[model samples]
Target: MTKTLFTGVLSLLIASCSQQDDRICEAVAKAPNTISECVHREGYLLADAEGSIRDVATAVVEKCRNHIIQQLLSKPENGPSLEVYATAIEDNAVEEAIRRVTEARSGNCKKPE
Candidate 1:
């Protein structure tokens, strides 16, 4: 019984230390800024046009539209600002990711600025 418990603990420790193939990480790695770029990457390949768009439980948009509305909301808005969206990646790395992603997302967000 002791041996079994020890093995289980060791397994848990190993799993905890292992690097996770996180989607956000992969997405950032593949394309730091834009959604289109990330979609072409391995994990994000599944992110291609999905369901329609919904507005706070309102009408829906065209079929197979980009379902990641959160991405759009990230644009620099003069309206109510929010800082709730953040990731755990290092600042430099995250900056790189944002640079890449934003480049691709160009013009799709808040008017060119």
Candidate 2:
């Protein structure tokens, strides 16, 4: 009976974590600019515990950066210059998201012991 209860609890926890991750990803995809809000929402869902927020944020940033790079590269007529690419990256939503993630990781969203 004890083993069954433990198994059930573990299953529920895993399901809850999966749901939270899905919600976070959806929010990021819907509004990449609103990364801070999404991070806060996920933090709340996880009770401010270290719950894959860093990993999710990193993945989001990488995907956004790759998409931007591809878009720039595809525009041969525009002759994408190094300065332009640097500016685009600096002024992008992904940078803001990464900053927020760093702040959150160092601040209130730290891993629980």
The top-ranked prediction according to lDDT is: 2
Q: What are the per-residue Cα lDDT tens digits for candidate 1 across 15-111?
A: 7545433332332343324433332231222221242211211111111124234454554566433443322112323333334333323212211
**Of the candidates shown, which would achieve the greatest TM-score relative to the real structure?**
2
Shift in Å, residue 6, candidate 1? 1.8
TM-score of each: 0.22, 0.30
For residue 21, model 1's alpha carbon misses the true position, in angstroms, by 5.3
lDDT of each: 0.33, 0.48
The alpha-carbon deviation from the true structure for residue 14 of candidate 2, after best TM-score superposition, in angstroms, is 22
lDDT of 2 by residue, 2-113 (tens): 9999999999977664442422232222332343444333333343344465555555455455455555555556666867765665356445555555544444343222
Score candidate 1 by lDDT: 0.33
Residue 88's C-alpha lDDT in candidate 1?
Answer: 19
Local error of candidate 1 at residue 50 (angstroms): 41
